[model samples]
Target: MLPISALSGAPIVGRATVASIRLRLPLPEQLPPAVRDHIEAHAGSQNRQYLYVPSPVIADQDASAPLCAFVSIDYASDAETELVEVSRGKMLKSFLKQNFSRDADGDQILAALFHMVEHLPCYLLRYSDVVAAAQALETAFANGDAPSLMMPVLPAVENVELGWGDSEPDQPLVRRAQATVVDLEGEAFGVSADQRNIVHLDKGALRVLGLFDVRTREREVVDILSAAFPTVDAAQIENDVSGAVRRFRRAGLLVAT
Candidate 1:
C-alpha cells in the first residue's frame, strides 16, 4: 500500500510509473493550481500533498544540458527544501555566469531558463523509476559528484576579511576572490560565492583569468594580454579585457573593490 500523489523528481532517466486513483471531483482554489487541477480533472484523491522536485536537467532542442543541480528534494522536509534551494541557487549562478561570459544573451538566457523552471510541467513517475533515480541522486550527492556548491568544510575562510582585498589609497582594486577554484582544462563549471549562479570557464576565459595576481589592476591586465598578442587591434584588446572583467565580476571571481 503506497501513498499516492508522490511526484518523483523531474524524470531525467526516462518516462516513469506513478500510482494514482483517478476520479471525477470538483477542486477548490485554496489549493495550489497544479494540485487542484490534478484532483479536479484526474481526481488523484486530495488529502496528501505532492512533491515537485526542482531539477537541473536543461533540455536542449535535441540535446541534454548538464545535470548541474541535485536530482531532487523531498519538499516535505525543511532540510531537504533547504538543500534544493542551495542547488537551485548554484544552478542560477552557474547559468548567469556562463551566459555572461558569452555575448549579450546572458540576461535573456537566464530569464528563459528560470521561466522554464517555474512553469515546468509535473509528470507521473513509476515507483521503480523513482527508486532508481533517487538512488542515483543519493550516490552522486554522497560521492561529491553532484553540484551542492558547499565549500571546504574543515578549512576556514581565506585571509581576506571581506573576501576581497584592499589596494593602495586610490587604486580600483580588482583582485581574485580569496577562493581558489580549478582552471578545468576541458570544460569548467562552478558557482558563485553565494551559490546563486554558475561559472563556466572555457579556454579563452581561462586565458583572461590567468591574469589574476596580487595588486593587479584592470589596465595591467589589459597590457599583459595585449603584449602577448601584439597583432590584434589595441581597441579590440581593450574591449576584450573589459568584457572578461565584467564576466569575472558577475561570477564573483574578480570583485571590483
Candidate 2:
C-alpha cells in the first residue's frame, strides 16, 4: 500500500509533510514562524505574496465599515506530497457544473463520509500500471472540462506487493489471494486485485476539490446577481454554508454524541 502522504502533492524536494489549514479569519503578523513559513511557501509557488479575500463581506465593505488586515491561508498541502503539473479539464468541469447547478443537493456530511469510507474499498484493487492509470484519469479530467462536472483526479501508487504468485507458473506457487491493504494515515484501505495502483483521496485532497467547487459556485452567483450595494449573493452564501457541512461530513469530523 502506498503511503497517503505521498499522494498529497507535498513531497517536494525539501518539504517534510503536507500542511492544510482552514481559514476562518485573516492571518495576523503575530503568526508563528512555522505557519508563516508554510504560507510563504504556498504563495511563493504561485509567484504571489498574499491571497486576497474575495468574499462578499470584504468586497462590499463600505467606507464607514471597519477594515480588515489580511487574508488567511486556510489550507496548505502536506510536505511529503509534491505538486505536479496536471491539466484540469474533465473532472474539473463536472465538479464545477454540479456545484453551480440548482439541483445539486445532498447530505454533504453523509456524502463525504460515504466517499471516505469508499476510499478504503477503492484502494484495495490491483491497479493497472501507474503510467497508464495516471494518464487515463488525467485524460478524463481534460476531456470532461466543458461544464465542470466530474473534477480532475490524479491518483498515485506506492509500496506495492503481490499477495499471490501471479507472475509465472514455472515455480511451484501456492498462496491465497488476499485483498491488498494500503496503509493510509495509519488506517488500511482495501484495494481490488485488478487495481495495481493506488489512488488516495483523503480529507485534504477532497477539501481542495471542494474549494474549486466553492470557487465556481461563487462565480456563478456573482455573475447573475444584482442586488443592493452591500448585498451578498444568496447562492454564494448557501454554497459556503453547504460546503462547511460537506467538509464536516467528509472528515467524519462531526459530533452526534
| Model 2, span 1-257: residue lDDT tens | 10111112222011222233333334554456765676656542221343522221222211121111111111232222122322222222223233332322332222222233333212111222333444544553454322211211323423344332122212222211332434433443323332322223344333423333222332333233323213876666545434543333232322121
TM-scores of the models, in the given order? 0.36, 0.15
Q: Model 1 lDDT vs. the true structure?
A: 0.42
Candidate that scores best on TM-score: 1
Candidate 2 residue 156 C-alpha distance from true site, Å = 24
Candidate 1 error regions (>4 Å): 1-171, 183-185
User: Highest lDDT among the candidates is held by which one?
Assistant: 1
